[model samples]
Target: MDQVKTYRTNVRIGNWNEDLRLEEDAKNEYLEKKQRGELAAQKVEVLKQNMLRPVDLTASSDGRLHFGDVVMLVNMGGENRARSTVSINADINSLNKTPSPAIQAPCGISAGQCVDACTRTAFIITSIDGSPEGSTLHFEQSFALRTTSGFAMGLYLSSDLQSFQKCSKKSRLQEVNLDDKCSFLTWWKILHFDPQERLEYEGQPVPANEDVVIIHCKTNHALAALGDQVLWTTYGKEYEVTAHTFLDSHKAEKDTNHWMLCTAENRLELLNQSQSTADNQEPTEANPGI
Candidate 1:
């Protein structure tokens, strides 16, 4: 009789365990559904915010790349500066070259369209001025007399341009690894390109052709480049710029000249972009003050 009682007790415990397992599984499923619903709601909110308020990419700031601000490109090779306006387009390749003067005209091109009329080379914005007619983006270089289109004729986003407000100021900046996912508002030091020796990190090979890394800082700081001098101001304190170079196996070199402080707003912009990608959602506009 004792043996039979022991058997019955074992059976009861087994049944209890099974019921508990089912309860736990149901709880997990409910939690997952709730999370998914919250995510969907967040995405809707983002879309709504963007639809209600569009961003202007030409507002003026003290040498920082702000939304709606027009930038001029100076092709140092030819000593010619061309004018172009900044738009809300995320694709930076949209800007095209115009006629020989390469000045900003009222005409606009769609994203990915090439401006076939001017010479292309890496240029810097020499002067930034704005007006209602349209902001003037001036470059520093003049084109050759040839009518041929230059391979470099496009509005290339400066790799040095950072979101400034996204990264943490206390973190040490270093070269980004292939598998590394860069967090928002973190500073990273990049090595400029060099043709001689290839760059390696942690015994793994890194490509030398691309910009070292994207860094985020605060927007309240000032960023300026004069000749070789790159300057950044934080809390009203200014810092001098320095040059760093790196090389990779592909016979390409990467170079970096200076640092800039990215603002909190910029950091949010980057975070939104990153979150959109990770979650397969789209970015919506937010209030500038937000």
Candidate 2:
């Protein structure tokens, strides 16, 4: 036999009072307390995402990015400070008719409502197959990059999950674990330019200071920096970064698809091609190197 259980919610609804009763005041106070609690939780989450996490550099001095290194994705397309490195752009718009930059470009009148789009952000590189440390990052295997706050970078998807983003394949950071199925968005692969060169170097470890195109593991679109589609961000005028592919039956963009995994200790500038020693790029944090 199935047991049926019923509870009482509005038992005193028959009583109507013109003046504010004691019970009404108590209920209103309780609602206010609950709302405060919810707001506190939201603020905590904001801090976790916006706060600058303390991450240490793990890239070695071997002139290659390893499997488990905390490196910065430096766009080699431009030399301006705004186009220096890729960072989070999860700024929410205010009630002043400002547009949201959660997964798009930032647009607003007041600078205070915007978040920093270039804050020297770093990401932890991990292998999808439990590859050991000190192992060079290769293209054949899948990889994931995560921030210290646990936000995994993934491709943007519509709420209905039936339609894909048009023209611009945008990406956003979603808090998820690597084992989660949704983590597929965080997985990506790298490939060197030049088909002949790539084929010749297939399965070979990719060098850190070389020009490479990063491809999304789930959508096959490549991460590209649009020099012509530059947008004004909170930081400044930055080259528009997007995951472009299959545009008007054409292939992905090439000129802006080059990126380099630069270490804070050893900055690798594309224009300058400065390969400094690892002694200066070594991080002071406690995270040991591979």
Candidate 3:
């Protein structure tokens, strides 16, 4: 009988399997955190059942009022006597120095209800350190009657009130057109023509107009137009005819004096007009016939 040979192989775990295990652990941890957050929010809602009330007693150590002492109150704004008794609670301690109170109570208190028969409003002591003064007392008064205008509290009465003003309507701004013209030509330098019922050159004879043809040096690409036209070549060159329109010869004369020519290519060259004499110059109203 022939002897049988058997081989045992050890298999190694791949990185893909390890990555999948890590992703699963991360997803489980995220879910656990979400559940915990929801539970904490529910606990906060349950705690809101208890409301705060002020005390009228003064602090024994400092003259400051304690959390539950009751006292008389008065409104200096209007000599209004309050009908209801005031109580000191935690709500009174939170008030700032400003007489105007921004805190909204579950039951609203009125200015008339803030004072007593002797013009003294009775308030309970709720907070020992009610204010920075330490001696300040916070009080609340309640009554069955409700005022049409809500009660004003704290410094809100003494301070200046702000009024709203209507805003003015916005005016539209005029748009300026820097590149608007009729006809033009580029022969190393650009020359422009005027716009009329029919297309014509500004200086050169109409028969020689040649339809303002533009020819690219390398590609020999050609573009032609009868009047004011703009052309874009494949080589990224743009040619515009009469890029600027002038009202009269006087305006055109001023532009020519300050005219600057620039190439669309990397290099910019200035066209030389010094060689042209007065006899060869074109005629214009300002130049009296060039």
Candidate 4:
């Protein structure tokens, strides 16, 4: 914020020597751009970039998840053939078609678009609460997970909500545009392996980003990777994901339901946030029933 202010001030009244000041002939141009909000917008953009940049990662470099943290959702205990995390297939290459043409999810976007899990894709964990871009994320706090491309990790339910809420069908592990929204499908909450211990340490920093269950805020179901429901992608075969829960009392939550917001430290290149496009709007709070 201070940096942006300094930049704005410097641009308005030259901070350099007199030689660098706009000539008298160009002073009017500067005032016009400033009045048009162009200079203000540029300053805001700089502020966003600076605040969103990590001051420093969680000490361990792989744990202590924070809001706005770029990460890979690593599936550890699942029946996955290989260790991986949640990812989306933009289908930039023609290597794909709707794997399930007849099926659709209520995510309000391309329902059948491929969303698979692998280690390659990166995600940014965020919240619409207006925290200063990146802040420490606490346990049980409601937050939205999104791909850098601007698709938020969420699901939607039609009238027969339960019919479309399970991981068995329709692949409800879906993404919607990240804007001002209060939908339960897009808001998620994380829980520690021991719910009791979670409460015991309620406001404290969530230990390492390990052994957690990410539940859909509305349905109270878990984000699950269906290892068996594999799909072919530009990255080859990847696991299909969906919101799921165990029905039978005998069937407890399995490793398939467990996940880690594994750090993207190993990512060969850091995934930067996309520049805010015209679609960017003031985010409304998604705090209801949170």
Candidate 5:
């Protein structure tokens, strides 16, 4: 059996002859409040429905690790501001927590001040097979650079994930200033990598591939690159492009008939590369294309 939450509102409608402005305004506000309350209730209901994912785990006093136990750890305030790690029995979860930068106090600082100067964050899973005193596993977290003005952070890697060390001397991190008023970066992806593949490349000194592209919402300002070369970029949209993906043809080699699917301004569009003569090349619009 399941319990259902109910939301209710009360309102009184006066006669047409009685033109009371304050009464009408109060009625409208009450209606708006009811609508918002219903929406919030729905969101909470969704979260409650998905409760199979446990929020936390605890270990027993006697140091023994079970076969099928799950452990989740969270690190606070890294360069990315937050990171989470989940270990399941013998194998580690695919998600990798980003590492925090080393904290160093300036010279001439007192010992107490030096300790206060370090506000770093990190999480280490000492052992997955058994207790911390026995297992011999090591985990390496990734790195990201965050800026102060905006919520966007740089992934900073070589042009090619395969040959990333070639141009490693330059600054990999930089600010992404868009033309449109974007609130923040929503979602991003590298066209060629899958979840497991992404995890495999995490331990490498240089990333496995660098065909990087950032897709933003509120504006269709998507920037794509192949190796170190910038292939395309667009900006100035009233709504953020919340989601995007490259169409998969499921073949070996690159597929020529592929197109990118972008969602923005409450619409789905099939965006194709257009060889325009304009200063900034235009992406061909396939309207109402599912």
Candidate 6:
């Protein structure tokens, strides 16, 4: 039996008026050349949905998973144009299941061109001691950040998976309301959003705590945070964070845990953080420290 196969590609046709604004004969020649390219491209299928452009992927506490972004093309110097999170069933092979749209943030640009183009760089799940339902999945959009921009923007998928809300109250696409001193990446690290380990809170295996992200940006500054609270910020021109790893030091030590960060210069810097939640010295009726 002879088999029929289809090949696919993605391309942007050049603007006729702009590219052919020369003499009539030159314009005609240019169009003829472009037409040949277009005809050749039609021989193969042009994949329209960018399912491989996701910057991050994470599973929920219940084992349901989601991935970020569906771009048309990720070109050079392109910013994140991802806009939604497509939720997947726990059993990936389940038949006839459609991707449920859970998180959506319209960029408010050209309609239908890129309806959901907000780029998401990272995703993390956090269950603070006092948060609603004890946990929520966070999606980060870092493409909108600048060197000195205020606020990293993101969307929050509620624990129940029923709604999506903006993490920043001033939820504009171009600029979100985040801390002035932090970019989206720094805050992402500060939140300890990745390399999640299975943890036991009240005697069950769940994703919890580990909310300390150390961000070493291009500015040669290292910043650490414990769930949004800045622990320390230090500057060293020679230090540019290249990677982070968990060092299992002080296995018997409960108060402080150690982590290692690799720098551009190939030096490892160890960071220690206290996990103890008790403070007896500054006990007050209305305020308790953790």
> Which regions of candidate 2 deviate over 4 angstroms?
1-55, 78-82, 92-120, 150-182, 230-236, 245-253, 268-290
Q: After superposition, how far is residue 251 of candidate 6 from its true place, in Å?
A: 30
Better of 2 and 6 by TM-score: 2
Model 2, range 151-234, lDDT digits (tens) per residue?
323222111111443233223311111222325665788877654577777788877756777777766666655555445644
Q: Tell me the deviation in Å of residue 263 in model 1.
A: 29
Task: Quote the positional error of residue 281 for candidate 5 in Å.
Answer: 52
Alpha-carbon error at 24 in model 4, in Å? 63
Q: Name the candidate that leads on TM-score.
A: 2
The TM-score ranking, best first, is 2, 4, 1, 6, 5, 3
What is the Cα-based lDDT of residue 253 in candidate 6?
Answer: 13
Clashes of each: 57, 1, 54, 0, 10, 10
> Among all windows of ten consecutive residues in candidate 1, which has the lowest summed lDDT?
139-148
TM-score of 6: 0.19
Q: What's the TM-score of each model vs. the native?
A: 0.19, 0.54, 0.15, 0.52, 0.18, 0.19
**Residue 181 CA error for candidate 5 (Å)?**
35
Per-residue lDDT tens digits for candidate 5, residues 1-290, read 78775644544455643667768987998788667543444433422332112222323223322222222211111221111111111001111113422111110000010001011101112222233442321113211111111111111111122124322122232212211121233222222233335455443322211222232322322222112211111111111111222234552212111112111210111011111223254455853323
Tell me the lDDT of candidate 4. 0.50
Whose TM-score is higher: candidate 3's or candidate 5's?
5
Error of 4 at 95 (Å): 12
Tens-place lDDT digits, model 3, residues 1-290: 98776643554456978998899998988778566533444323322212222222222343222333222322112112111221112132222223432222222122222221111123222221223332322211111111112121211100011113311111111111111111111111123322241223333321211122212222222211111222222112222211122234433222211111111110111012223444577878888862
C-alpha lDDT score of every prediction, in listed order: 0.26, 0.50, 0.24, 0.50, 0.23, 0.23
Cα deviation at 136, candidate 2, in Å, is 2.3
lDDT of 1 at 209: 17
Can you write out model 4's per-residue Cα lDDT over 149-207, one digit (the tens) per residue? 31222322211135444323335443222233345557777777555476776656554
